[model samples]
Each structure stands twice: as C-alpha cells, then as structure tokens.
Target chain A: MGKMELVDSDGAKLSSALNRIARDIDAVFDVLLPVPDDTRAPLVEAMRYSAMDGGKRVRPLLVVATAEMLGVSRDPALRVGCAVEAIHVYSLIHDDLPCMDDDELRRGKATLHKAYDEATAVLAGDSLHALAFEILTDDETTPDPFTQAELVRTLAAASGMAGMAGGQMMDMAAESADYDLHTITRLQQLKTGALLAASVEMGAILAKIPREGRSHLRAYARDIGLAFQIADDLLDAEGDEEKAGKALRKDDEQGKQTFVTLMGVEGARNQARALVDHAVGHLGQYGEDAAVLRALARYIVERDR
Target chain B: MGKMELVDSDGAKLSSALNRIARDIDAVFDVLLPVPDDTRAPLVEAMRYSAMDGGKRVRPLLVVATAEMLGVSRDPALRVGCAVEAIHVYSLIHDDLPCMDDDELRRGKATLHKAYDEATAVLAGDSLHALAFEILTDDETTPDPFTQAELVRTLAAASGMAGMAGGQMMDMAAESADYDLHTITRLQQLKTGALLAASVEMGAILAKIPREGRSHLRAYARDIGLAFQIADDLLDAEGDEEKAGKALRKDDEQGKQTFVTLMGVEGARNQARALVDHAVGHLGQYGEDAAVLRALARYIVERDR
Candidate 1:
C-alpha cells in the first residue's frame, strides 16, 4: 500500500475503534449505574448523565487497544476500560465544579454541577470514584484476585494526591506562580500524563506482561501523554471552541502558564510531532499489531478536538 | 468481678484503646501524607490537617479490635484501620462542603473547606478517597492479594453510591422531602451504617473468616450500625454543642426527618439501648475475647460526641 493509503487505512481503523469503544463504555456504564426508585435516584441519574455519552473515550480506547495488542481477551479489557473511564469522568465532574475550572459546558452539554445541584454533583463524582474500584474488584471483571488488587493499586496511585490531584494542585498554582517549562511539564505529567500512562500500564497489567517487559509501552504512553497535552494546549490556543465542545482559551484567560505559553505555538507543535514520532518508534517491536495505538498517538495530535 | 466492677473496667479499657488507636492512626497519616516542598504542599497539608487528630478514630478502633479478637496481628489491622479511617475522613470532608451540610466545625476544628480553599478541599477529599484503596492494596497492608482485593471491594461498596454517598444524597434530599421512618432508616443504613458495618466486616475479612462463619459478626455489625446512628441523632437533638464540639440540632432546624423526629427522645434512647444490647448479644459466640467489641457497641450509644 502507498504511504497515503496506509495513513488513511490506519486513520479509518482508529476512528472505528474509538467509536466502538465509546459505545461499549457507555453500555458498561449503563449497566453499572442504574437509577433506583427512591431519593437516591437523582444521584444515580446525575452519575449516569456525567459518565455516559461524553468525552473522546481516549483513556478507555488506549486501555482496550493496548490490551488487545498484547493478546488479552476483550471482555476483561472492556471492563478495565470502564474502570479507567469512571476515574476520568469523576475527575472531570469534580474539576468542572464552580470552585475548580468552573466550566459551564463539557462534552457539548451542561457540566454535572450545572445539570444537577452542586451537592448532587459532588456526591455523584464521589460515587463514580468508588465505582472505579468496585468494578476492578468485582469477580466478573476478573476472577484472579492478584490482578484485581494490582489494577486497583495502579489506578489509585495514578488518581491520588501524588498523581492527578497533585498535578491539579500545581495547575492551580500556575495561575499565580511563575512556572517555567520544567514545572509545566511536571504539572502535566501528574495531572494528565499519569492517568494516560496508567491506561497503558493497566493494559500490560491485565495481560500479565510482567513489569520489566513494559518499558517500551510506558515510553510510548509517556510520549503520547505529552503530545496529547500539547495538542490540547494548541486547541485551547487556536482550535475552534464549538468543535472542542467546552470553553477554550480559558487557560490564557486564567493567565495560567501552559505549553503554548512556555513554548511558542510553532515550537510546541513541532515538539508534539517529535513526541508522536518517538512514541510510534517505541511500538516498532509490536509491528502491525500496534497500528491502532500508533494511529492513536497520531490522532492525539491530529484531531481538532 | 461484680457487674459494676466489670462495667467500669470495660469502659476504662475501651477509652484507653480509643486513645491509643487515635494516636496510631494519626502517626500513620503523618507518614502517609507528609507535605512535599512543592506547590502540592498545601493540598497535602489540608489532607493531613483533616485526616489526623480528629473524629474519635472509631472506625480504625473497630477494625483493629475486631481483627485482634479474631487472632489477626496488630500490624495489618492498623494498616486496614487507617484505610477505613481514610474513607471516613474523606466523606466527612465532602459532607462538610459549603454546598453540603456547610458545617464549619469538625473534630473541634474548622472544616477542611474552611481551613483550605474549596478547590483544595475537594481535591484533598478525592485524594484521600483514592488513598484508602491505595492503602488497602499495598503489599505491606496484606501479603495476600485476595485479601487486598476483598478489602478494596468492601471499602468501595461501603463508601460508594450504594453506601455512604448514596445515604448522603438521601440526607440532602431530606431537607426538602417529606420522608417517612422507613425511608429515614434506609437512608441512615446507607449513610452512617454502611461504613460502620464495613469496619467490623473488614476485621473479619482480614482474619480470613469464611462468609458462613461471619453471620454473627454481620449481625453484630448491623445492630451496632443502627445504634451508632440513633445515638448520633440523639446527640444532635439534645446533646451539648460544647460536648459535641460541632453545631447541634441542625436536623430540627432543617426540618428534616431523623430518628429523633420519627421516634421521640425517650423512644430513640430505648431503641439505641436495645440495639446495643442486641449487638452485644451477637458477640456471645466469641465469648470474653469479644469484650472490646461489646464495649464498642455500648460506647456507640454512650458517647456524647
């Protein structure tokens, strides 16, 4: 096949995979969160609303794609995908609160706090946080208790203070502090990179690939994580707000130092491209089986959203 | 010993145990949440401030006492106790948010949101929620992966939508809804009772007691769980704010239906006493070795705060 044809084919495959996983995740969340006929119904409804039919499902797609490439079955992979998505959704719900990012729109709809009251939004986010662990430890997710425990540890470490929340703290400080490129990189690594890396790590974990064997995959995830953030910054700087589906340019508005601010737009774009190239190189060992992942890495930079 | 002497001795033992576990949990949290010399420092400080030196350490005490009674070592029990306490602390932080109960005082000090900013408070609670699972799944907590997974499942179930958060949702609705006694009972069961029951259940889990063997312990937990909430309601109705160290009678002010509202003060007191007696009776299978558990049940009703 010609190079252009190869790019087109890979792009088609990635798009199809993304669409499929998004639907799968929505189905899983539907089954996971059922509204009860009681006072708690609104809470469950809010949780379902914020969790389903939202986002690019990038985290879940990464998990499922990487797990499948490693010869793992799709059932466990989808369940684990849902677990990571739950964490992602919960964080977004909390982040969009009036006290945090205060964004009114998410995934082309009202944020959780706007859709429901703040109290219900907080409880719903918390419930989803708990649901992540619940799904991981459930026997139906994986009968192997060791795998279950390992999954929980991976996710908890990535989501907790030293990881996503810690990164967020740095981001919050970015509004006031004079952050250099090094600080911004570290901030992004924790806030966004950690969970992205965890998605790949969890895939290897489900395959029982052994920690030492996952260096290449970790490098791939790290590169793509950075590239993804840069692209996000670029989108916030120049991409269409309607396509992004949330308020863009808020980073600039907040005077928060980001990749685009630290590095010029051209410099940041080149850096993201370099990272994507490096990320794809790490997957050369997996050959064609890694096509979707490589495509995902490219998609991280290429997509408007 | 005479009945009076036995009662006095048990009370003394329970008090000492409570004090000791409180210190132990604080020390564990101190180690677990050291303030890093970075932007995340404030987040860690907020977490440490709320998690340590507060709240009677009742959950941790229950985990340790019950585990020790079942012949488990103290080290693992303390770790598990810390895990449960982390969940309890996180819930309290979230419940005290301005959008929630809006309480300024917790554990005789300012609530987390009052101490830190609202965003930091939200992140700290989320971090602590993640930390609970992290502690449970750590190899140091339990060498057995099965046990670790089980612990995560128990804590997650108790703290999530079907548990404490679900109950909190009901509690929030109580301000506007006309709830009957049955609804209130169910609400309390999910809110306060779930974690309380999980504390005892976790001890049984750590001891590797089979599900069938845990029947009496489950019954004991169920009884004590209800007794604990009823006692709390009574405290809210008439207990001294100085003694409680927080605002009291807010339930009456909110016009919410509580155990005190559904059952009058004398009726609630009798119900709590009956629950304590029933909880203690269920521990007969453990004989004198269950003395601490029995004391804890009585203390649930007897505690002023």
Candidate 2:
C-alpha cells in the first residue's frame, strides 16, 4: 500500500511514463509559458522552480489514468495533464508568497519569490494560472468548443473562491486558536481537495464518461482529498524537514487548524484510514484497472514525506 | 457622430441604462465578492477593494449593448458581464501595485493594494482572476455549455501573457529611454487593446453571433482598442492630474514609448480619430444596430477623463 510496494511492482513502468510525461510537460511549458524575452529570466526561473521542483505528477497522471480507464488514448489528456500541473504549480507559487504562507522551502528549495523577487513570483504565479486555461483551450487537442468550455468552467470553479480560494479563506479564518473541527475540515477540503477533485473530474469529463461514473470519481476525489490533507498534517507531525523538503510542524507556530489539531494524532490517522477505505470502495467499479488509483490512495496516506 | 451630439440625444437613455445596470452590477458584486469574515479579512478586503471600486462599468455596458444589438435578453450576459469586469478590475489592481505602476489612484480612489496592503491586493487579484471563469461556468443563466466553453477560451486568451500580461510585460520593458512607433503600438495593443478587444469580442460571442460577424466585431474592437489607448495617452499629455485622477506627463518622464511620444499631440489626435472611424466602418453590416458601438468608440476618443 505504501510507495515502497508500488515502486517495487510497477516502478519501472510508472517511472518511464512519468519521465516521458515530464519531458513533454517541460517542452510544452517552454512553449506555453509566457516569458517575455527581456523579463524572461525571473519568470523562467520561477516557472522552472515551481513546475520542475518535482512532485509525483499525480494530477496529470490521474488525467492519463482516468483517460485510460475510459478506454481513450492518453494523447488528448496530455494537455489536460499539463493544464492540471499548471494549476497545481500556480497554487504552490502563490501559496508560498510572503502574503500567504511566507515559506522559504518548497520542493526541496527556496519557494518562488524567495528564490526570485516578490514581484517576479507574483507575475509568475499569475501568468501560470492564465497559462493553464490557455493550455486547456488550445484549438489543437482540446475536444469541442463545448467540452473546452466545460473544462474551463470546471477548472475555474475548482481554482476559484468556491474551491481553492474558498478553502484558503477558511484556512485564513481558522488561523485563530479556537477554530472548530468542521471549519478546519471545510478549509482543507476547499483549499486542497477542490483542485485534486477537479484534476480527476476533468480527466473523467474529457474521456466523455457517463454521469454516474463522473459522480463516483468526484466522490473518490473528495475522500482522498481529505485523506491527503490529514496525511499532510500527519507528515508535518513526524516528517523530517529535509525529507519533506519544507519546514515541518511550522503550522503549529502559525496556529493553523489542521486535522491533527482538530482530532488527536491517532484520531486523525483513523480518519485518514477511513477516507482511504471509502476511496477504495468507490474504485470497486473500475475493477483491476483501478490498480494505479488504488495504489495512489494508499500512497496518499502512507507516504512519510 | 461624437460625444457631445450623442450625449445630448441619448443622454437620458444612456444614463438610465447605466444606472440600472450599475445597480444590478453592484448587487452582483456584493453577492459574489469574497466574504471571508474575520479570519479571512485580508483576502476579503483585497477582493472588495479590487472589485467593488465604484468605476463606470464600460466593459459590462459593452456586454449589454452587444447583447441588445443581437436582440437577445441581457439576463444571460449579466453574470458574464460581471465576470469580465472582475477580470478587468483584477488586472488593474495587480497592475497598479508598486512593482507595476506604483499608482495611488484609480477611478479617483486609492488603488486596492494602496488602500489595503500589497499582499491583500495580490491575493485579491489572484482570486478575482479565478472568479471571472467561475461565474462563467456556474449554471446561472444556463447558456449552452458550448457557448460557455468558447467564452472561457476567449477570456483566457485575452487575459493571459499574449493579452493583458503580455502588454504589462511590454510596458515594463519599455522603461528604457528609447523606442519606436511600431513597438509602442504593439505594446498599446497588448496592454490596453487586448482586454478591450476581449470585452467587445466576448460580448459578441455571448450573443451567439455568426463567425463572420464575430471576426468583424473583433476588427472593430481592435481599432477601438488602439483608439482608446491613443486617447488615453493624449489625455495624459494634456490632462490635469486632479481631473484625470492619475498622474499626467508621467509616460514622458518615464521615457516610455507611447503614441504621444512617437507622434506630436495633434498627430495622435488624428490617429485616434482615424482608428475610431475605422472601428465605425467595420459595423457597416450591422447597420443601425451598431449605433451604440459607434457612440462608444466616439466616447473613447473624446471623453475628458
């Protein structure tokens, strides 16, 4: 269920797929990112730092995986994958800015604006967010005008106030010492889970899946999103800063209300386990083809970092 | 044909429309803007300052005018109109920050980041950008999904690096002491013209106009956009800072290339007139239906502020 087990079994294929996608992503990033020639240095550096800092590409991979599950070729999903990563990168870029988390560490290095200047980081984030939609709407691979519209709406909704921004608002609100559990979970769901849900839901929609399946996928994403946040809190509780590539337990100083804050550490772990089980149950519809997804849910909870 | 004549004739109607739409737009803004309570005060205030500024909703007016031209109801375009305004306000908020323009005034009031702090302004801009699309995708008026998708792509392209950001980049790059007319024109197109173009073109799309008509509208918008920028530059050249609510002759001091910098004031006036004439010419196919657009173009070049 852990990264070790998944790595041992499907390590080569996933690695090769990830490597290929990363190259494609980097190439596409080169073209799609708007680095005006004169001011390109800071933007290029910021974009590379945020985008290439290296995550599992889980969202983009979900795009490909979801497409695969729907019996569609992965090519069309490539742009969606790129778009999803762009959103993720943009969120990370803004989240790390001095106005927000004011963090120095992200992906094992200085957060954007810290590595670059504040203005450059801000522009980079803004440009990247715009670029994500631009990538989604490219006339080349995007389905029809209608589907493109849906994609736009879906991603926008997820990234905006009702989704990530809403969560961020809640998170900011919950910064006080007495935030309740419901309020904290609400923040995490909207802030972190919304885009993750959109990442999967976007892939499903692109594959033209039926409504029933789409709903199921949304449910699965919701469960895992909460589970992922809980896992994040758990990691912060015990994770090494070097391995986690960011300051650990920093949320405590910030008085951030997290799952572990709301529920005791053991209770938070139990909740995460329950969410994972719920997510896996939803995957029952996909059968053995859901193996990657199954492994992903496990990885979400069990990863040390 | 120009401002004084149109103002004398349709002043009542325009004022009433403006008043009604303004109220409607205000209500929408109040309802849709971030309400982050005490915890999220920073994000909320930032969004409000950027979005709720009491500016004339010219872009939203365009949406209404174009929709009326096509004999469609304005209800569907209402939310989209607000969405466009959100993007516009967000862009201005971000653009007026110290790193961008260091401006203190917009619509005769302090700019968002200036009124609040830089961080809130940044977050407000970011969230508002996302909010624009969120409004488009929400099932408010139930525009066809295809139409919504096209709107998404259109707005994204208009707002991204190739549009607003690209223009901002050119503006930033033009901080040097020398530049030519063409570069100046290009910069103006990206900076001021791009969103203006989106304003008109997006209105056209929302009305579900034919492709040929859409192209013509874009051409008309392109001309008007240039005219708008030229007129603004001319105003700055001769404008009173108190009336303009922004500095005058600053472009000259910055050594930035502008139409006024390239051509003498008289020449810029001639260019603005020509562009407006060209904008009017493109509406020949629309006949009497384009009267409001023609009026708008005239107003752009002739308004005192």
Fnat, one value per model:
0.94, 0.59
Model 1 chain A: weakest 10-residue lDDT segment is A1-10
* Pairs with steric clashes in candidate 1: none
Using Cα atoms, each model's DockQ against the true complex is 0.94, 0.56
lDDT of 2 at A200: 85
Local accuracy of candidate 2 as per-residue lDDT tens digits, A74-192: 76787888888988888887778776778898878888877777767777777778888877777765657667767888888888767887677667556564778877777788888
lDDT of 1: 0.92
Best by DockQ: 1
lDDT of 1 by residue, A49-162 (tens): 998988999999999999999999998899999999999999999999999999899999999999899999999999999999999999998899999999999999999998
TM per prediction: 0.99, 0.91
Write model 1 residue lDDT over B1-305, tens digit each, in one string.
68677677778889889888988888888888888988999999999999888888888989999999999999899999999998998999998999989999988999999988899999999999999999999988898999999999999999999999999998998988989989888999999999989999999999999878888988999888999999999999999998788999999999989888999999999999999999888988887788788888989898999
Angstrom error at residue A49, model 1? 0.6
